[model samples]
Target: MGVFVASTRPKVVVTRNLGPETMPLLLERDDVEVVVWPEDTYCDRKWLLENVRGATGLLVMLSDRVDAELLEAAGPSLKVLSTMSVGYEHVPLPELAKRNIRLGYTPDVLTDAVADIAIMLALMASRNAEEVTAVVRNGEWPKRPWSPFMFCGPQLSASTVHPQRTAGFIGFGRIAQATLKRLVPFGLTTCLYAGNPATPADPAADAAHARAFGLPRVARVGLAELAAESDVVFVLAPGGPATRHVVDAAFLRRMKSTAVLVNAARGTLVDTDALVRALRERWIWGAGLDVLEGEPVIHADHPLVKEPRCTLLPHIGSASIETRQGMAKMAAENLLGGVLGHAMPAEFTGTK
Candidate 1:
């Protein structure tokens, strides 16, 4: 009898369709068997758990959970999991480390996109743009009579009257740097960022930023100073237990009453109840958020939603078409690299 050989194709499961821009990379490969979730929305957990069995690699969204149960179901054959989003909180790092699975995430590709949102949120929050727009949407724009100083709020730019502005960042990362660069045109005088205190201070790097951005001062400060002095505070920090609720009532209470808060980062970084209280008590002027603690399902009656001074989005920080396509392409490349035993293009080794 003739000898029979089995196919050595690696099995890859995709949580959501990557569309034509990225799917062709995997579909054209004869060495890979690709199984996609086949839907527009989030992939159902039941379907994911069932199909993820024997997967050699998985390209997942932030909605999918890559925990011990998923890892066990994927068996020893699962060597890689690449997330389309920059955040990886959905995937447990310990579990991946235990199984020697490489983690890949899209990072720099979305930096500009997120920074744009951060600035937009700052402007919107300061101007109360959300509530103003709602008047038009609710068919009350014609009925509501305008008065002098009716919609007046803090201005983001520095004029002759307000010659200097200080911008603050919760985390000094690529996105935060991009945001600082964008603020240069607004006549920002000083830049302050808060990072892990355990990490050594880099005066040289801060000096470089000041020189590069033409700012008078670029310094690192503690959160208390950042909250107190900033005209606008951008929350661009990473999410995890270490950073959870970093912006509690104490932090919010310290902020300038006219200063605006913009959070384009993880929702858990800010304490929701504290924020609501701050807005209600007028401790801060307003807030613009692209993410919320219990997100993707915030009801209309949700306190933040009902708060006229608050402008919120459904975590669309990286929703730009160019950014999404780039992320999809990178995620596909990472999956292929891990499956083929090659070095991933953007493998996350975690902070040292």
Candidate 2:
């Protein structure tokens, strides 16, 4: 090599501090110029705009809104936009499409972690884990003797001769497979899934996934069938125009009287008002929600809040240490790939 040119390095801007593990990967590259935010929190809009002015790549998080303003600020040099979240609702796709910018997102990497949270939500909701723990902490449990059926909740793994258990999915995907696998031991033998049409590989791949999980059958059914047949229904779908309020009053009415609902996905997929009415009217046995519609500011008078059977969480689906680290690393890789003129390892193709 006669003379190595340092001018070939492309500029990359990270919107947040990716975990320590990912720092080495970006630093090791000579063809990439990486600029990381010193703070552990989200980067300020002004700072981001200033830093991203001449950058070729941007690695952002769900918290950061990559709207037209941010994209316009990045100018002609920008080649790629990557987010660490599976949900790209925050990004403005139309603007990116106009500029021919490639997008990257971490999807399958955090699937198992999210599914684990979904299962935990179901278990906690069904067993009244929150209230029970509160009672003990407040010294109420010690004051009173345990009575029959007092604080008792519906059994998840009930033994039966026929084993007629059924689970439903609002949006079935990789995380759904992991959740189904965990529920198999609880005598769950059937599943009903309802959502948008399968992708090119979805039909065959879904069947294989179902079989591998030991589920007796996994059928793509309508919303009504999912509501009526399932003992527990998990909402794992994406949030957007087509799926907004997919689960409404009409769908809730069809659910089995003893059924439970769990949602670890987007809040927009469910009608909070309709869900409140359903819970108030006892249409379903209970509900477990990690994500809420109009979150961080839920109405105090919300019906789900008053309903004893409802369990609410503040959306910590992918909160695990390992999963979050992986997400950060993948996001960094996406930015680095764009900066280095290579294909992203987990690029968001905007298929859906």
Candidate 3:
């Protein structure tokens, strides 16, 4: 028998340290040359461009943009582009498609992690967690005594018999399903969802999801119905032109005065200005946001920053150490899958 050798070991460039557990998976391949970025920090564009030259695969984070210029810099050898994130908005898809680059991303892996954060944000925002923390930290707790409705917000587990106890979802998907599972224990009985209609293949997935969650009914309602009926509306949709500002002024206006809003999906899905206005004007009860539109560059004076009713997180939806490590390992697999000409274990089929 003749010893088989790979024609040429494919060159792989990982933009960051994918954690200790994942490095072994990439290193086990005998027919691959893996080059990790030197620093434990984000790779600069110039460094990425220089290092990516002549590479066969590129594993990146959402911070790095896989645009046409980067693809050109990488040359025709670039076969795969995998990101360690569920969202692909940062990647230049058309450019990648033009260059015949395969795309891979971690989607389902982080669903449960993100859903847990969403529910936490909803609870924190509704209960004024930040304000309460500030009060306790500032030594005001000893000065002031607890009183009825002093820092009270809407009760999430309040009796389902009340018509005001509905939960709404802007985009219902796997994460939404997981979130509903957590909410059912809180007495959520009615759920309203708005997104692309259910398909024939998964004809009853939506209905089945409702039954599994123990919700009395789950219907695909229009944006208006979702806004008007929900006591707590969660924005769990993707970001893009079509779904941008899905929670604008008009939608916010329709929400019940006591309703709470939670967004753990994308920041661009809601207009921050409109949300600030809604909170200031009492259009909706409050808002909990894990992701912000402009991100780390959010203005210090942004209205949401000053609004007491809004709870803002620094985009830590997938910050759990275990979940992050899993995502990194999955992303490495995706890149290796493309390099080895095998189907990715978790491949993105592209936007429908």
TM-score of each: 0.96, 0.90, 0.93
Give the TM-score comparing model 3 with the true structure, all chains together: 0.93
Best by TM-score: 1
Question: What order do you get sorting by TM-score, best first?
Answer: 1, 3, 2
Model 3 agreement with the true structure over 247-324: per-residue lDDT tens digits: 899999999888889999888999988998899999988889998888978776987988878888889999999899
lDDT assessment of candidate 1: 0.93
Residue-wise lDDT of candidate 2 within 187-259, one digit each (tens)? Answer: 8878788857643335676587678877767888888888999888999988888888988999999997778
Q: Per-residue lDDT for 199 in model 1?
A: 89
Clashing residue pairs found in predicted model 1: none
Residue-pair clashes per candidate, as listed?
0, 0, 0
Which candidate, 1 or 3, has the higher lDDT? 1
Q: Give per-residue lDDT, candidate 1, residue 91.
A: 90
Query: Where does candidate 2 clash, by residue pair?
Result: none
